[model samples]
Structure formats: C-alpha cells, structure tokens
Target chain A: MRVLGVDPGLTRCGVGVVEGVAGRPLTMIGVGVVRTPADADLGHRLVAVEQGIEQWLDEHRPEFVAVERVFSQHNVRTVMGTAQASAVAMLCAARRGIPVALHTPSEVKAAVTGSGRADKAQVGAMVTRLLRLSAPPKPADAADALALAICHIWRAPAQNRLQQAVALHTAKAPKGRTA
Target chain B: MRVLGVDPGLTRCGVGVVEGVAGRPLTMIGVGVVRTPADADLGHRLVAVEQGIEQWLDEHRPEFVAVERVFSQHNVRTVMGTAQASAVAMLCAARRGIPVALHTPSEVKAAVTGSGRADKAQVGAMVTRLLRLSAPPKPADAADALALAICHIWRAPAQNRLQQAVALHTAKAPKGRTA
Candidate 1:
C-alpha cells in the first residue's frame, strides 16, 4: 500500500510518501516541507498550504493520506495553526476520494521507536534506519512525517484484522441486536 | 460595498451577505446556515463547508469576505473545529482573489451595539435595526454572521483613514532615515 503522511503546520508542513505493506520493507518515495511566509495574511497562507498539498497529491497520488491528529492541549497558538493546516491536507485528500487517516504524535513515536515518549533525535534516528537513508530527513518535521507514514503502514493491517473479526462476529450473531 | 460574513462551525456554519457603506443603512442580501452531519468525517465536513461558502460567493459576488476570528481559548474541541471551518472559508475567498477580513466577536458586537461586551441578543437586535429587517435573523450564528459583515463595513472606513494618515506622515518625513 502507498500512503502519504502529513505533519501539519502553518509555517512548515511536512509531507512524506511511503510505499509498502505490513511485515515488509518499506520504501520512502518522497519527503519535503511546505513553507509559508510568516508575514503573509492568514487567508493567503491557507491558500498557499492548499496549493502545496494539491501539488503533492498530483505528484504522488497515494492511496491513503495520514495526517498528524492535532490536540488543543498543546501550545494554544500553535495548535490552531496545526489544526488549520491539517484541515487543508485532509480536504485535499478527501476531494479526490483518497482515504485519510489520523495518527497521534505518541502513536507515531511508539510505532517507530517502541516508546511513546521518544525524543525528536530518537525518532529521527529510527526513521533514518528504517528508511535506509544516509541521514535523517532534515527539519525534524520531515522525520515526523515519515514516522507517521510508517506507523500507518504498519498498523493498518492489524486494524483491518480487528475490523474483519468484528464484522464476522456481527454477521454470525442473532439478528435484531443493536450495537 | 458587498460583504459576505461567515461564522464558522463544524455542525452549523452561518453565512450572511450585506451591502452598503459605513454610514448609510446596510442591506441584508442573504443569510443562512450550512450544516454538515455530526457523524461525518472531518475531511468531508470541510469539503461541505468549502462548497457552501463557494455557493454563497457565487450567488452574492461579494467584494469582501469577513469571517469570525477563531480563538483557541474557547472550548478546546469546539475551538479546533471552528478554526478548521474558518480556514476553509478563508481558503474559498482567497482562492477567488477576494479580500478576506477577520473580525473578533467583541469587535462585531462593539460595531453594532456600541459595547464590546454586548450580549448576543443585543447584537442581534442591533443588526435587525441596522438592516431594517422585521425580525432578527434566526439561529444566533446567522445573526452573528450578519453582525460580522456589518462590523467590517463600518470599520473599513476608519481603518482606511488610519492607513492614509500613516502614508501621508511617512511621505512628509525625511527619506532614508530609519525609525
């Protein structure tokens, strides 16, 4: 499966594409950041983000788009920008019927580093090793983007199994029972 | 001047259009709410908002788009949705090259009711009076949207004069001298 991961931010939105399935070696297709000027008006900044994400979608056309889920508990100012950027990324994907998945920061870290509380350097190092790159993607955000894609690629299989189990159980059970 | 006002929300997005200048009586061209199912996914919700805002833009052809400024200090979950919805509204306007303006709730209230802390009912009443409508717009969000457009219409003149004053002073000052 091919997936695009987005670490959303207004100033620097990180995007990366990974191709592979669970229990197999994954390949990094592309990774980069979309930067918007700080001085630009909010409307124009959002437009820039939309354009950048659209360009990525056109170039890669991944089957799924994974966005870093935003939590309002973070720095109040930064969280708003993150939410806005993520919305743009999700919108771009959904407009084209690409499935969008959301992964929390801890989920991405835990998937790659075996610990939910892993530091940035540790996450970066793990991404470099997993992707077999000469070095970690620059700007930390890029590394996080790769981590998100890797996490989604690894977790999806297990999730699908759970979903299938539930479906089968539901079908075999007595009728007229509500969830 | 024609202005479209947007009060952004995930479940119910309010939109209104007003036409007139700062001093003269304003006309309420249109007012309504765009609703998305609460169970809908985030990306689809945003797409719905974009389509709704775009339809308003096409029908009204407003010169300016005024959206309520989202603050992260509000209900955490609700605030994130508001920020996301507002981003989509701004994106729709900016993509079309229409000037976008953000008005705070306090500013909208102050512009209409002469008090920044005015209650929603007061603001709604004033909007009705200003627009010479027989009744206030239904759903507080709709009223708030009209208030936003009215606020933008009334404030733009003063803001313009302030800009002109600063430009004039700069032109009269010595050149090549840093402040």
Candidate 2:
C-alpha cells in the first residue's frame, strides 16, 4: 500500500509519502512542506496549500492518504487555519479517488514508538530505526507524518475485512429471486 | 457582498446564498440541499458534492463564503465523508478567488443566539427571529448555515480590518526593487 501522510499548518504544512508491501518495509517516496510566510494573507496561504498538495500529488501519486485529525487549539484563528489546511489536503485526495484515513497524534505516536505520550524526538528516533533510514526525517512534523502513514497501514486491516464481508453479503443477496 | 454558506454532507449538503450590503441585513437569494445515496461509492459522493457546489456558485455568483468547519466526529468513516464534503466546498470558493471563512458550531451558535452553549432548538428559534422568517427554516443545518453567513456579515468589520492590514503590509514589502 502506498500512503501519503499530511500534517496541516498555515505557515508550513508537512507531508510524507510512503509505499509498503505486505511483508516488506515501506520506502519513502518524498517528504516536504508547503510553506507561506506568517505575514501572508489568509487567501494566499490557502492558495499555497492547494498548490502544494496538487504539486505533490502529481509527482508521487499515492493511492492512500493519512492526515492528522482536527485537534483543538487555544487560538480560534489558528484552529480555523488548521481546519482549512486539513480541508485542502482531504480534498486533494478525494479528487483522485484515493482513500483517506485520519489518525490522531497519540494513535500515530503509539503505533510508531509504542507509547501514546511519546515526544516528537522519540517518535522520530523510532521512525528512523523502524524504517532503518540513513538519517532521521527533518522538521519533526514531516517525520510525524511519515510515522502516521505507517500506523494507518498497521491499523487498516479492519477496513479490508469489513469491505470483504460487505462484498460477500451483497454477492449472495437475493436480487430478483422470489422467496 | 454576496456570501455563500455551505453545510456539507455526503448524502445531502445544505447550501444558502445571501447578499448583504455594508450596512444592510443579509437577504437570502437561495437555499437547498444536494443529495447523493448513502450506498454510492466514495467517488460518486465526492462528485455530487463538487457538482452541487459548482451549480450553486454558477447561479449565485457569490463573492465570499462561510463554511461550517467539520470537527472531530464519533465515526471515522463519517468524518472522512464530511471532510471530503468540506474540501469540495472550499475548492469551489477558492477557484473563484472568493475568500472563505471557517466557523465552528459554537461560534455560529453564539453569533446567532448570543450564547455559545445554546441548544439546537434555541438556535433555530433565534435564527428565525433574527432573519425575520415567517416560520423556522427547514433542516436546522440549513438554517444554521444561513445563520453562519449572516454572522460573517455581522462580524465583517474585523474580517475587513485583517484583510486591509495584510494588504497594507504586502504593499510596503520590498519587491522587485533596484539593488
């Protein structure tokens, strides 16, 4: 499975793309940010986010998306910004018929570091070790995003089973047969 | 200014268009829902959301938008659907260079009812009274969405100030200056 993970922000949104086979390790396709200066207008920032996602999608072509869920922030305006960034990434995935899964920070951290309360440093260390990378990913958020995509793969078995069950039920249903 | 408010959903999205002058009340130009089946594939649902937004934008030719931001939900799949719906609305607004504002449930409730903790019935009643509706608007979500657009107008002074501040700062930047 190929997954694109995103950490949405107004100033510098983080993104990581990874591809994994059933038994093999995930290979990092790309990792980067879509940045706008803090002084930029909200419209410009939103535009940057849209362009950034589109550019990455065009290059990497990830089949699955993993994004950070909306968490509360103290600043109403900041929360609004994060919400918009999340919306942009989600739309980018939806446009291409890609399936998306939203993961909480704790969920991703735990999956990566075996602890819900693991700090970014710890998560980064674990990701570097797990992926056996030559170097740890930069900008903390990007590393976190990569870890999140790996987590979603570990957690997505239920989705496949449910889809399988539903398919079987539909296939065996009484379509046009009299009782 | 003409502002469009969209309350997005996979099966049915509520859309309302209102035109408000600088000093006058927001007057409704149109409101309705664009629905897709629950059993339809994810692609179909996204298409419905996009088509619905495109149709409304074409008809109303709105200058701005206020969208109800999707918060964390109990259901993972439902949250994914809502996020997709929201992305389509944002894309529609962004494509036209229309400024989009994100509002939380509490913010909309407080703006319409003067209480962040107001219940749905209280909110619906207050919106009807505030808008001078002959009767309560159907599908509380739709009315709440209309209330959000009106709220943006009521709160425009601050919005305009921010935009103006951004413009002034950008204008003063040293761009393409002779070295």
Candidate achieving the largest lDDT = 1
lDDT of 1 by residue, B1-179 (tens): 89899999988888999999977878999999988778666777777788788888888898888999998888986998999999999888877767778899999999999999999899989999999999989899999999999999899676645533443443222111100
lDDT of 2 by residue, B1-179 (tens): 77788777776677777677656655777767777667754544565567678888888887677888776544545655675577668766655656678788788888878988899898878767766678767786677767777777777567855754544454333121000
Candidate 2's C-alpha runs over 4 A off are: A41-44, A71-80, A155-179, B7-13, B20-27, B34-50, B68-88, B101-134, B150-179
Listed in order, the DockQ scores are 0.22, 0.15
Cα shift from native, residue B84, model 1 (Å): 0.3
Per-residue lDDT, model 1, residue B111, is 92
- Flag regions of model 1 displaced more than 4 Å: A158-179, B158-179
Q: Provide the TM-score of chain B versus the true chain B for each model in turn.
A: 0.88, 0.83
Q: Which pairs clash (backbone N, Cα, C closer than 3 Å) in model 1?
A: none
- Each model's lDDT comes to 0.83, 0.71
Sequence-dependent TM-score of model 2:
0.69
Q: Write the per-residue lDDT of candidate 2 for residues A1-179, one digit (tens) a residue.
A: 77888888777688888888545777777887777677754555665677788888888887677888875533445655676677777766755656667788889988888899999899989888877788888888789878977887778667945644543444322111100
Q: Give candidate 1's total backbone clashes.
A: 0
